[model samples]
Target: MGAEENIGGVAAILRPVAAVIVSVSPSGCVELRLPSRRRSWRCDGVGSAMWIALRQHDGRIGEASEMLAGIWRLDPVDVRCVMNSWAAELCDAGFLRLEK
Candidate 1:
């Protein structure tokens, strides 16, 4: 109903659809062998939002969160929850920095 919900809905649909093009399979998997998706990759809530948000940002969590919040009119607190969780996961995975 709101812009945030619209953005989230669009994101929810687009990412999974686009993930077909978004995902990389460099493991020598065959054209037919690649999975539609893995069970573990499905996520929800702020964590899922964060994951999609960060991936869409070219890996820039800060700008992604700000843009995501602005475009969606979501509360900063909610946006922060998405971003912080994403940053934490990325950091744990050795993919992102604490400050940036």
Candidate 2:
């Protein structure tokens, strides 16, 4: 199955896994660590921004996309697509979980 299918599409709610450790640098770099899985992921630039926005918006993809779209002056639909894709990646990597 595809990432989108696994995540139940763009409207899916996502939250960081409770056991995962997250850290952000002043330079907008993000690090996610799942000690149980012995896995870690690092994000910078747009990825970092998206992660921050996702957390700020309480895992609401639409709200995060809107915030990014406005700041980047990009189409909302395009921003949403990017956000959804990124979210799916994070979910598959086990740093995030689907809430609904």
Candidate 3:
């Protein structure tokens, strides 16, 4: 089974739109929602990553780069910075892992 399958098709919904797989934690997932609605999703993942990260995801491919930068990592923040330029289009989809 794939990561999504392993996670119960929850993150699967984000595969198409997500740039990188952010950390998944017990609280919830940090993915971008890509539905035709303005309301997106957000992730409450673990680590200091989330503390400084925004707990939301969006489907707008334009903002992927920015989202990646704010991912609580010290990597190149250029792409992430540019991605934030479109924060309006981004959606921070939050999902709870299905209880086994």
Who wins the TM-score comparison? 2
Summarize candidate 3's per-residue lDDT along 5-85 as a digit string, tens digits: 234434322223333333434555654443444444453443223322333443322234355555535344554443333
Q: How far is candidate 1 from the true structure (C-alpha RMSD, Å)?
A: 12.7
Span of 10 residues, lowest total lDDT, candidate 1: 11-20
Model 1 ranges off by over 4 Å: 1-41, 93-100
Cα TM-score of candidate 2? 0.85
State the local distance difference test value for candidate 1.
0.47
Tens-place lDDT digits, model 1, residues 1-100: 1223233344222122222222323642211111444422323444545656666766555556787788789876677665666455444433333321
Model 2 alpha-carbon drift over 4 Å, by segment: 1-11
Residue 27 alpha-carbon offset, candidate 3, angstroms = 5.7
Clashes of 1: 0
lDDT of each: 0.47, 0.84, 0.36
TM-score of each candidate structure, all chains considered together: 0.41, 0.85, 0.21
